[model samples]
Target: MAFLVVSRYSPLFAILFVASLAGLHCESPGKSPAFSFRFERFEKNRSLDAVIALYGDAEISDFVVGITRPAVFSSGRVVYRKPVRFLGRNPSFSTYFAFSVSSPDGGEGLAFFLAPSSSPVKESTNGLHFGLPPGATAVKFETRTEPETGSHIRVEVGGEISKQSSNLSNVSLVLHGGEKVHSWVDYDGDSKRFEVRLSKSSDSRPLSPLVSYPIDLSRVLQREEKLVGISSSSGNSTQTSSVYSWSFAVKRGAPYSMHSEPLDPRPFVVRARESPPIHLRRTYPWGVFVAMVFAAACGGLLTFFVMFVWFALIARRPVAPVEYPVHPVEVGYQQIELVAGEKGVDSTKK
Candidate 1:
């Protein structure tokens, strides 16, 4: 019993318990670059587990990004469901947005220009079907093995069921394995012009420019009131793909393109006014300090009570006493033996 008690309260076990409690109690900062809606979850489940849905005419400009691949479904559509409208007002300048996906098999990728539709169709494996609403234009970024040659990048534009294939004449942009890509799209209302550019890292030189193409926005969308988002899937042969970050912007100004200034994508510390730190609120820290001290005192009292009970039981148990017998010793003397009773009788008669 003593051994069991000692083992249960070992130093290693105590340390592990305290460490786990600290980790479980620690909190992290909230999401940033606020949006109408934001969701981040694994690919295995199609449900949106973590989401922030905003109200009113607030435009979502920036997003902190991350994604994982070999998703279950090839056509994963994110529809900006109604009651949530985008580009409500006529703006002078074009909107800007970007998307990036990481894939072991970088063979298949697709981007969509979506509209208000009841039902959207899924894309095929290895970038076969570009997931888009009916009557919407889709730009496919395909990196697949050709029958007669090595791997190459091809661009395909589709609307509804019709598709137009175009071989990239300028092979400047090459997406490598496990690379973080930054691509942007600018929609200018004045010129009715749209431009898309993809950027990547360069080992020898500065950041290499992947591909830049001018798109005619007027020709692309059949209707002005359409919802837009990105969708991607994996190949039939068990390849994985993932999308990291996506951002959309809308403002009143001339349509112009600018390279995103490189900044540390690391999380920053922002002190929110409404939700201040608990420690900074009044004398709460002191109160918490007192509460913790009281709890510790109670715990110590409990431990002492248990120990007292244990010792009391040991004290009350019955124990056998040892006995010692004492023997008396006589002084040195000769012992007299009676010869016969007759000798005594004869003496009496005489």
Candidate 2:
């Protein structure tokens, strides 16, 4: 009787043990999170429905998000209306945006950033740290050129500016040119690779990134809901910064697509934004020189042909001899030539 009772209950105990193990497996901390949102442009009346809140001087008008006014000490932030769960043991994300910074004199610049949802915005002209909150992780687009760093893009953590992650002194792109500039920022949680790509609205995403720094998001960001947004500020110099479109997505188990479809109508096509390589730049002068030399030779040949044709077919014709017409009186004079000659001879003799 004791052996029978033990056998019957052993099956139930084994089942319970298996179910507990399954529960533990499902809630593993290594699992990645999922969050995605895209903004091609803001609608006129539906700005509030876009799930974004404007703070300070930030405003949305006619499908554009204006982050800051063109006035000194002006600063603003356009952040998500609600906090998002952006943290996992290893969190990865990809984001793309089209922005423009325009003014007579370029302003400080702007940033696409992530911060603790509870952190408050701090307004300051403290260089690249403007409009950022504590414990914020940002990729800043710096337009103002300094003697030491010039124009650059850098990653800032905890509202503190660090050495530029990527230098833009020699790049052809003008951040404050008042034209739409597109940028892509992607991170691989598994590889700890953080990349930043910059281009024009008409250009495609570059093959190579401007900045690819090794960063562990788990260390930089807190394991809580994050507020994702863009921030900008103007110092003594004033500039207008606008966001034409923006898209962001947290990576899942599958590889994230960089060119995912946007929520709104696509703005414009994109070509490659890479600068010409050193070899190509070096060959450009030779190519132009060759073209000019060929053109000059063609012109010289044409001139020579025109001159030859003139001398051969038009300028060397035979000249006609001079002629005098004989009249009736001239004929009579000719008939008396011999008599006249004899008289002249006799006179000379006498």
Off by over 4 Å in 1: 1-73, 82-107, 119-128, 147-173, 201-216, 219-224, 255-350
Give candidate 2 misplaced runs (Cα > 4 Å). Answer: 1-33, 46-50, 122-128, 252-350
Model 1: weakest 10-residue lDDT segment is 49-58
Per candidate, the number of residue pairs that clash is 8, 3
lDDT of 1 by residue, 22-132 (tens): 644532222111123323221222232223221111123322222213443344444344322333233322222234444454436545455444334332223334344
Q: List per-prediction Cα lDDT, in the order shown.
A: 0.40, 0.67
Most lDDT-accurate candidate: 2
Every candidate's CA RMSD: 22.1, 33.2
Q: List the residue pairs that clash in candidate 1.
A: 66-244, 69-241, 70-241, 93-253, 94-187, 123-129, 124-129, 173-210
Candidate 2 residue-wise lDDT, 1-350, digit = tens: 33454465557645655654565445333332366776656654444455777887888776688988878767788887767675556777888788888756757788988888777754443433557766788888887766677668878876666437445757678787788888888888777777888876666777677887776666665466788989887767777788877777775332254335322223432323333111111124655666566557556655655654455555346568999996765343222222347447332221
